[model samples]
Target chain A: MSASPHAAGSTETRQVYLFATCVIDLFAPQAGVDVVEVLERLGVTVHFPAAQTCCGQPAYTTGFPEEARKVAAAQLDLFPEPWPVIVPSGSCGGMLKQHWPRLFADDPARRVQAESIAARTVEFTDYLVNTLGFRLDAPAASGAPLRVALHTSCSARREMGTLGCGRALLERLPGVERVEHGHEAECCGFGGTFSVKHPEISAAMAADKLDALTASGCESFVSADCGCLLNLNLSLEKRGAALRGQHIASLVRARMDGAAS
Target chain B: MSAASLPQADARVSPEDFKQRSHESLHDAHLRQSFRGAMDFLVERRALQFPDLQAFNTLRKLGENVRQHALAQLPDLLERLEARLTELGVAVHWAETPADANRIFLDIARRHAATLMVKGKSMVSEEIGLNHEMAAHGVECIETDMGEYILQLDGDRPSHIIMPAIHKTKEDVAAIFHEHIDGAPLSDDVNELIAIGRRALREKFASAKIGVSGVNFMVAETGTLALVENEGNGRLCTSVPDVHVAITGLEKVVDRLEHVLPLYALLPKSATGQAVTTYLNLITGPRRAGEKDGPREMHLILLDNGRTQAYREARFRATLQCIRCGACMNHCPVYTRVGGLSYGTTYPGPIGAIISPHLMGLQSTRDLPTASSLCGACGDVCPVGIPIPDMLMKLREAGRHSVAESITPPAQALVGQGSVRRAGEVLAWRAWRVLYSHAALYRLFAWLAPRLRWLTPAWQGGWTASRAALKPAPRSLREQLARRRAGRTVPGR
Candidate 1:
């Protein structure tokens, strides 16, 4: 999954497929829009394949492999071009990059296709910091500094190993203070179906994560994965807490705009 | 003492009530705080031990490779171990079930006419209900390990594997000792409590006819049963008694003595964050001709129970590589918050979740697999790289699909396969697959979801309990992207 950033940027036709994950599709479309705007600004042609739907992570992680395979099979041929497939959510990106090969291992025809596509799959923040080398020229504001807490999803941290990529992106901003919170590496407990399956346990985890982020005295938070954003932000809203999480795509896009202005 | 006269546990906890148990455990602030602190301490100690990430990864890989190599030749190694032990005058018994192992123990006790048995901390003993079995047969089995001894006195089951009484504070332990032991003082002092347990267990160790223990590594080449512990109770259990019996899972055997070194190197560090345990007793056999301080008779029971079931599956074979290090639980987010007691199984935490379904079957342990969030913390810290999350996912699949629907053959299917397969859940997933697989259907639904966001339910079972209700955006990403392609300004922008 690691291609040289210079090689990525120097490509004559630097076009990529945007796998705007299902969560970002229905709930956080602004994140998808922000990602598109940022990539266009970086001179990368972002193609949103209409055929792409779900990544089948929900079914796969929920133990319905057969169902997951069917759903994953749909998107196999959507990225026919030999271009990088950039996913906004690490969870969905991981399902494509890591699990897709295994999901189609039994089928010889799909196995080759899965592996080929998997090599091109990259998380959004990873593509930004590594491939594009896009960083903020200055802080988001010359006024009061933006105190932000970055929440890295477990999938992003362990599976994708893109926590550093997101952290680097945010830390580069002169005015964006990336505050460290308690159990920074721990999960936010928004494990797709896990949130609904064991609600109490999931709620407890979200509460702790929210409290830690709030306790860090950050004005807002950012996460690479929208699932964690939805889980943490909604939980904070439910608690009537002022702290909330934004997708890294939206946060980075705003920072880039601020620098440009 | 008749078999009927033995006291039973006050409450026989079952994994069937995992949801309820976890709910209650989550609500207990004291229990939550206790486990959080304990786990944090253990996690920190482990981090300190493995200061160099590169070295830790290399050693962890070596440990995993050794176990994997052992597992590949498990049958041959086990046979060799049995032969070696037999030659060394150590009675080696193969048990296919928990009952078979307990029965063999009973037969040995009956042969010796034993009324008392002293035991070191043995998870296999717990797995087989060894103490209750011995007590039922008029043989009193005393737990010599301070933590287990405290739990035994309180009539409580072990929550954590290594730290059995970790759920209890020093004060709770002191109270239990004061109430159970005759003329014992109620003191929360750690040394005093340990002394009280030792003073009580010393008499039992001296008088007991049989000693019971769990082997850490059964070295096939050397015919040695390597037992690791901190308090020296394992050495005392095997040496002080006339007859010593050590039981372990069939998967514990390694091909050589050298193989145990790497595993042993990783075991204590991964388990209790110690460089090495206090005692590493390598029992070759019974007392030699000149030896005066060893058991006269030695027995080793290799219990299969449900391990063979797990070993049959290639993916699940990794589950057997576990050294019972308990590192997975210490770093697990779910285990740290909920505590081990919530599992309601003999072995709790990440290891328990993956292995319990095999032992107890998917029907009873269906909830255990799903309890975790598939967080990779357990897998990251597993001493042998068991890939616990993958194993849990496998179990979840095994438990959810019917025999015919499952890829696994009927004969090779997990016990109680499809036990937790609810018609509603299956239907829901099927519908999800249908909708998501079709591009037009998915887009339509995606568009409709946000457009009708107001119609979204206020209540969504457990999802809305601690979080606001999930509402879709005003427009779908696909719709917005389509508009952008058509050179139109997006409404939100």
Candidate 2:
């Protein structure tokens, strides 16, 4: 989306294309809505093309190269403009920004389109902090601060190199205190389809992740990707833990709108 | 366990068992606490020094190009290196496997009439299980590297690449030294610990008839073997003995000194947060007649093992770019927390996870590919820009296919027949939907699903284990759209 909440110009007025990820589309539509609301509040005009489908990450990761190429071709055709594609989910954004070029190696036309799109695509938090130069409003040291734990999704932390951005932004929210989770960068075991394919190993990994999260002693947890949040929430809920989960965008929006006390 | 009493197969643990054991072992309160402390220390130390090392990307690119260029010209460089070493009166040997490499080294030892062999830190030797092999052949082998020597005394495999004894606390080292070193005063003081290791290895360095060491880099231009180490053991192991043997992977060859300089700069910085190690020894075919301290007779064993096979494949050839800096392992979230013993390979962490399956075969290490969360941190922190995550995925595909092929007769029959029948049903279902209205048939099938629980397999049943309960969608998309057009709420709502 556009820059920070307090930028000189109206970021909400700027035009942004929302790349609604397939997982969010099918499972967690509220995350996509939250992204739109956050962007609009920051003064950005959001556009969601109905023609947008899957980012081909499912097929691509499953080793179906031919099917992935078909999906990439359709995606390239669907998003033809040069405007920045703001992706709400880190995994989809990472796939489009980093992996699309490798998907269509033989086709020159699609490869060029993939490269152009990748250059303009940005993860939501990184775009807000780096591109928009958003300065965080430091919360006053008053009242009881809510302890929050941060999890950096694998794609966003390692692929995008924004390991600290989410935590940095969360610390700025009023009445929120960020606690470091042990093995915070470890996988949440939500690797798409990996959970279903190898449920034993996947569940074991999720248990380890939950243990680390619980060790942080934070009542609420936040992560950069919706997929990780969903997997983590499911695990927590299954264990009957009352830990709250929220996306960083929603937290920032809440702070901006003065909804969080 | 004593060296003589140790079981042979215990050294080679199966990957499945390794994963289960590591998962169990990592949960130990003491081990987890120690690992957390060590990982935090390394991460903080590394972060402070390279807070914004902008040139890291450039260095990685250069390292990648240099390695690729070296691998492309490997045959020519090997020939030239052999020729130059021959000119200097040194022998060169090539071995394709651990047995062959060990036989070559033992043959040299036998020819020299050597009873004692002093060794520096050599991961290749570890890969081949050379230490136990040498001991089995009645040749007493002593580890000269301080970390290696401590691990040797503790009767354990290395747990970290650069820092082999990283898992051991100071108290562990003290206990090890107290047990092994006869009448030697033991202390946990870091310098005293160093002194104990130095005192123990000094006698081996002087009395050993032959020396063995691993090459950090090999310069093809001058036939030089470069050994980089923080301790001076590598220097002693390469120079003090009458007969010296240097073993290295074929992938270690570089074109010239200039190409290795940038790598040398990046290696120590990334590995240990040091600008340079204590010693960077370059031996050009061992000792000349005028040289006083160097070994009189030198031998170079360039072992291929499985490296050449990996190098030939374009997709995996990037793995050869690894300089063994251990930076990837240091930063890896999985490797850091679980420790290296969990990997059950000579090289541990991200690099090992990718390359070991190729070298050891997919069937043996099927579990390693699934070890990662596919975090891509290894690729980012790699000094040589290896696409480690991509390689791991490829390994996973290979593992899955291998597993599918290896399924038992009954399992295979069930899967084979079920898949074909399912395929036909799916095709027929799609065809029927396109040709006619199948809304009633779909509703009937959906209604019967919950009653027919026996049709689902255990793995599929496990998929819904976390869900509150499985429930069918109220209406199809087309029906929902029609309902919206009529301005009526859907049935589920």
Candidate 3:
């Protein structure tokens, strides 16, 4: 946990900034805590700038880019440069790495700053596998592995390419097993505001996702995006379904603590 | 193919109103299953076609270049096409509106004293309501494509462009044929049904004085019109009858014959995943005096319903590049789930979502733009490289500002638009925009959400409609982190 894994300077001690997006800040704080624990255990010093807020995805995806730009433009200043910004949620990582640079396209000065931020940002799972080179050490399954379903968020697949990293992280755990399901590539229909805007279709799609997850015979689920986790967990709880979903960080941390749920 | 549940089977077939159609389609188990199977097959087939990534990209780039070049010189190409067509003795007509186009067709039919007209599956015809217009003039417009023929007999509009009868199962088609066609034996075998339809349609093709078809590509270099199909109906519509009348949107024009190749190559493949359709007919002119078997007279009717509206905006012209391949819908999660009937437009799926608003205007189609999950699958599969998700978002912004027409009584806004404005939503987002832009207020709002979680569902639109409850967590990460930082005296993480 002592040797610095990455940085341009290779100073032997590397520090990283955590952009715990608004969703993690509000709806699922435990996921943020688990992210910190995981990174600290890997010997990376994690710093959270209290001034940091959201990645402005709600407004950006909702057809209000102008309103989104106001928040997105301001976020570029929260973290100073060259820390390799790590995000727990791929949706927010997409907003930072993929969406923010586009927001400042018309302005040269801000666009440079935005691109710099985007270049250094990485989703936690992707960083864990690619940069840190930390392999999972499985002790033993003790006869039965804990079956957990994994939901790959849409942005995570498209922007971050973190599905591999998430799977690789899960593969390292002693008793944790990643379960496969039909229609895994299809969206879970929790498209932020789209769920509320078209609730009938949203609920129908969520029910279908649940059908696939439960059919896989997994007792619980974990996803990189809290947006999907929130929507899926709410539906599961509402239906009084036996299956539950947590953010991948919490699931991994919980597995490290000897339980899946 | 599965049969729909008996009670609500026939309840919501029309798309005159999108919301009602979407509501009923989501509840229609039969329709859902039918679309699911058809789309899955189409998506898998399309993926298999371009297994070589480098070749696929090459083909896509070529298609995009051809489309962009043609669109850049559309007016000049159309004039050149008209001149070449005049020299070739193929009558070319310009129709400004749907009424004009239909009138031209009826006049052509009357000139030949045509009573029966066999047609290829033409979506443009559906858009202009040409069959209904022809029927009013005592002309029997018989659809030759098996899918179109089934829907024609059922008096239902096309649900999808390439596969018009996809919403109907073999059993549904069997029931329709048995009910509508006299002495028809009930059969669920697709080949048997196709044979029956071919037998019935073949009888009319010979006796009909005029044939109607839609043009896939209008080649300006040689004034040639290309028709692509699987059932061989398009060839019959253009060649079997003495007088051939072809209809298309103005945007289908190509400057050179070679320019049409890349598009024609991708059209069928993107549609049904075939390397090539069974028929690819290119008609240059009418039958010469010594020619064996072709149309005696040929006419091209270019309809400009709302294409110009799209052309006026630089960004919107991307929609015109589409070849009507239906690949977008095949990969579209939303369209596959709800089916095309829910779109209630001539074009359905992602293309329809962007194009219908311009054709029908923002007044009636405000909800169409918001129907997608913005997963970008439609954009990914588009052959001509139309960024449909970008256009969808652009249209959504346009809808928010477009003047609201007085909605008729009893038809409230589906989500939020028209006469019924979502005042709370406007305030909620506006307040959010203000708060999130400032770090302090953003933290304050995030902290307040969990404590006042009960108030969310009320303002959350329809998110809680089916669920028992939807709530936020008890604490914010900032508070938790602050607590840890205070207690440990050393930022642990």
lDDT of 1 by residue, B359-382 (tens): 989999988898888879999988
Which pairs clash in the backbone of model 3?
A: none
Q: Positional deviation of B489 in candidate 2, in angstroms?
A: 16
Give lDDT per model, in order: 0.87, 0.71, 0.81
Cα lDDT tens digits for candidate 3, B217-273: 999999999889888888988888999999999999998999888998888889999
Misplaced by over 4 Å in model 3 are A1-11, A141-144, A257-261, B1-16, B402-424, B453-460, B489-493
lDDT of 1 at B343: 87
Q: What DockQ do the predictions score, one after another? A: 0.63, 0.20, 0.54
lDDT of 2 by residue, A142-247 (tens): 2346787888888987667676677667655657888887767677776766666445446656777888888889877877788888777766777888775777
List of chain A TM-scores, every candidate: 0.93, 0.90, 0.92
TM-score attained by model 3: 0.92
| Runs in model 1 lying further than 4 Å from the true structure | A1-13, A139-144, A259-261, B1-11, B408-411, B488-493
**Worst window of 10 by summed lDDT in candidate 3 chain A:** A1-10
How does candidate 2 score on lDDT?
A: 0.71
lDDT: the better of candidates 1 and 2: 1
TM-score of each: 0.96, 0.82, 0.92
